[model samples]
Target: MSFDSRSVVLSWTPPPRDNNAPITHFSIQILEGEHSDWSRYQSISTQNSDLKYKVPNLKPFTVYSYRVVAINRMGASEPSEPSYLMMTARELPSGKVRISEAYSGKPDSIFVSWDPITQEKIHGEFLGYRVFWKAREEDGELSRQADIKNPNQTKISLSNLRPYTAYVISIQVLNPLGAGPSNTVLVTTKQGVPSTPANLSVTSVSQTDISLSWYKPEHSNGKIIGYRIYYNHGRDAEIYTVNTSSDYNIYNISHLMPFTRYEITVAAITASLEGQRSQPLQIMTDVAGPG
Candidate 1:
């Protein structure tokens, strides 16, 4: 049997006298709020001798009693001792919403930011905070370990995540004794689209074809890099593609029909990533000069 300010848990072994008799069941009784009768609060099969239960949202400084009984083919054993106890929960002060900004976005990692709790809540007591997160794949909330006592720093990063997925997050305040409720938020990672290319312009135009050049956008965070170029003679014409590493800035199309009107576009690609297409730039193939 065990007692705390919040709950009572009791367990016991079945009597050896039931060696030949088949075991039957177990039961738990709660006597609370001026009740003298042993009401059947919960019950279990004989295979289960141990019973654990909790009563939540109880008033502070209130006492409660709990008892358990074991039943088998032979009969029920005498009820265990009635454990009476008072509960004491930690105190927390209320305040406005405070939080830290989430850190840089990554395919597999993210950082969270937050401010420290008000000192008034600390009053001779040590306090901490909790961060809760849930990946898109999971159905329930995942919580981080208690942060450093009276944490002043504002940022925490969660790493080792799966790519191309969504995540929801929340934060909570806690003290030496217990934790406060959580604050919730949502975030999604970069999935299908790539970054826009920079410095795009027509590099060359001729009777038969046109060449284009563009600079790859700078990715300070080190993502995979590549580029995709798209071209067509007109809005109704078929589009063709050319893929190249980020180092390649120039593309030439030599097979266009002479003197034909053409439209061209460019898009940047990352390592295993494809981004939005750049604005389409149109150019008319020069009329075959003296052809």
Candidate 2:
């Protein structure tokens, strides 16, 4: 556990009471420092059953040990062995910050801004700041990688980001002792273009009309607003757009020439970008409608 300039915070697990009486309270005793004596606080343990306390107003750099005991209707149990440790009080930072501004800095970069970690919240020494970020859907805090590692900067430009993607970001303080906890922010990069739709096929065909459907693209990193259907008969090209506010993966085209051959392709669209078109599917219309 880290320490503030004036006090040391001790945290520990309460001894198991399984199949035994539930713990009613605990007593903490101090055996070091200028105030070395049995603890003067009792109900202070009501904060939680996981035993923890902050012994304050002591001089720094002195060794210390804490003794703890559990009490129930049967009376107080014998104390557990004392934990001995000490640290010269050090400074750390705490904050609840957010990305004040985020924009696409370049084709493959995003610039992020944050509120400064105030000097007062810095408990001990003023060292530096760190900016940690990851893809929005990534898992495990220690798995892939972390922060921007800026000494005193409040803003950073993150490069090499995938277009139209979301990222989770955070900021923390660092001193000689260690780094402190940080709050997480969610941000999204600007949209580029969506990946091409795949598996274009004619689900059904009939005289003077044809029905078709397609699968969504592999990298539709943005929202799919609609689809564009392209059809060509010999020389002329025709386009039809399907504005989908709801789920739609199929369409029907009428007024096509009976027994005529046509080529068709499909493309997915987002609010600001159009994805690559699918491979063309050539098909001949039925000589007669299904009767």
Tens-place lDDT per residue, model 1, 68-162, is 67677678777777766433343553432266576437776777777776644432254566666667667764644436454665677777655
Q: Model 1 off-target regions past 4 Å?
A: 1-192, 218-225, 235-240, 271-273
Cα RMSDs of all predictions? 14.2, 14.3
How many collisions between residues are there in candidate 2?
2
> Native-vs-model 1 lDDT?
0.59
Number of the top-ranking candidate, with TM-score as the measure: 2
lDDT of each: 0.59, 0.70
Worst window of 10 by summed lDDT in candidate 2? 40-49
Give lDDT tens digits, candidate 2, residues 1-291.
Answer: 556666767777877763377777677665655355546422234344556677676544445566777777677777778666565465445544445887775545778787766644555565666677777766764422345445456787888777777777676776666677876667787776767776677778888888987777777767888898899899988999998734447789999888888999888888977888887889899896566
TM-score attained by model 1: 0.38
Q: Which stretches of candidate 2 lie over 4 Å from their true place?
A: 1-4, 7-88, 95-99, 103-109, 115-120, 123-127, 137-152, 162-165, 245-248, 286-291
For candidate 2, the per-residue lDDT at 260 reads 87
lDDT, model 1, position 285: 78
Please give the lDDT score at residue 165 for candidate 2.
Answer: 73
Per-prediction backbone clash count:
9, 2
